[model samples]
Target: MTAIAVGLVCLLVLGLGLVVHVFGRVFEGDTRPTLTNDIVVGTWRGADDCTFTFNADGTFVARNVPVSLFNPPGTTAPADVARGEWELTAAIEDPGGRLATVQLGFETVGEQGQVGIHFSTRLRSNTVDGEPVLYWFNGDPDLNRRFILEKD
Candidate 1:
């Protein structure tokens, strides 16, 4: 009887341990990659054929990018090439962790002459087929009209 009681207690403890492990995984939040300098220092392309090249020296150049992306909503204009400075800062607090905010400031030389523009968005990260991917949303997320730029 003593041996049986000990075995039962052992089983109970193992079962509790298994339950905790499963619950921990269930609440582990998302698998989004953490924003870092090394992860963001690269080229990213958008669906609109806009390419953003980020250099290690905290500078960036964007080509074939729509002017509306940097302007207010409903401002339709042609694409423009620009060069500027970029920075990342901690922003959103997620269940997984805090995400970074990306800020871009550039000057576009068009028929209207050189115009300075500044844009800010949250830096989002994800994985595709075991590869880390980074992106930023260009429009209102709730409306589902999002312009996404994916890392190259």
Candidate 2:
């Protein structure tokens, strides 16, 4: 009809300029680090599974103590532990909005697990509870890596 309405207005201006260029590259930085809902017994990093517990009328528990990076040189390693039990979704909208520390769980630590455990991870700002500290910062681009927590 008119070249299909100018090809649908050039695909709606190229999908609104690709959603405003990925929302301006995630808000052009300054504040994109979340996860901190009252220092619940915690621990998380990498190289294997992690941990985090909470209790103060909120309820929480996390685990991921598994390590399986690479194997086949002799077939001698691959333990995928993945425990879970969380409930602290203060307010998470997404598209990057109102994210306070969302963790919904029902995972398992044994191999091949399931029951419910939707992954919505994101945390940083080292917390403390049992003195056994735990820092979580996967901001990436800031390889400086200093958002730390100790005593796990």
Candidate 3:
């Protein structure tokens, strides 16, 4: 009975250690980018030719984005201009608050007065090839569905 109890405790400890290691690695290499209001409040272009303009008033405009980029087939994918709201959740203007990421919500208004939030994404800042980029996973397991953007 004593040996069995000790073995169970060892297994439990090993499992907990593994969990801690995985959790620590989650944000390990993130190297959160330095974010500032001036640097972020501008127009950004995605690889798919979509443009996102972040205004100073916490408003945003999304243009030239295709619905098919996100929605699967057999769905109502309307390619249209979207209006949305955005904000810097981490650092208002401080570069030290580099850990900050942006959250945006977009809405689509139909012709018959139907308004709905059709898309939402969280963008994290990173540097690629000596240039800044914003990226997010589009909820696809294929990895290629990841959306990336660069300053326009």
Candidate 4:
């Protein structure tokens, strides 16, 4: 009768709404920052002391940097400024049985630039150090200092 038909319609509508709600949550899940987005991106200067922009769009550009100034006060200048492009190479999880890490692939248009391009780093969990970071130099420096990654 009419009552039976009405009950079925109500149930169908409610079921459809529930399905939609669940699907929405699933789609939002992939956008989550796999614990690496917590890492910050910032500007950096190295041996040449050039000013550059480390964009979130995976492209970078630099203008003024003293090639010779990167040397120690007593050391002589290299006679060339350094500049380059950088991109996220890889992101790895720490084997502490916990998820962590992300390495970037870096290339350059000038002479002598390395994978030490990305900086302004942070962690998903506060269980790590945030200052004067210590990690692998990664095909960049024989003996390098912490390149200041100034967040724009």
Give per-candidate clash totals: 0, 4, 0, 6
TM-score (C-alpha, index-matched) for candidate 1: 0.62
User: Model 2: per-residue lDDT, tens digit, 38-59?
Assistant: 5444444444444445555454
TM-score each candidate: 0.62, 0.23, 0.60, 0.30
How large is the C-alpha RMSD of every model relative to the true structure?
5.7, 15.4, 6.9, 14.7
Candidate 1 ranges with C-alpha deviation above 4 Å: 1-29, 71-74, 95-99, 109-113, 143-145
Best by lDDT: 3
Span of 10 residues, lowest total lDDT, candidate 1: 91-100
As for TM-score, the candidate ahead, 3 or 4, is 3
Q: Where does candidate 2 have its weakest 10-residue lDDT segment?
A: 63-72
Candidate 4's residue-wise lDDT over 1-152, tens digit each?
99999999999999999999999987654322333322434654444454555557655555454332233355343323334444433234333333332233333334455423322322122222333221224224456533333333
User: How does residue 100 of candidate 4 score in lDDT?
Assistant: 35
User: Which lDDT value does model 1 have at 118?
Assistant: 58
- Displacement of the residue 77 alpha carbon in candidate 2, Å: 42
**TM-score head-to-head 1 vs 4, winner:** 1
Q: What is the lDDT of residue 13 in candidate 1?
A: 100
Instruction: Give the winner by TM-score: 1 or 2.
Output: 1
Best-to-worst lDDT order: 3, 1, 2, 4
Query: Once model 2 is optimally superposed onto the true structure by TM-score, how far is the C-alpha of residue 62 displaced, in angstroms?
Result: 26
lDDT of 2 at 40: 43
Over 72-126, each residue of candidate 1 has an lDDT whose tens digit, in order, gives 6765774566777777665565544454456676655443437655554344566
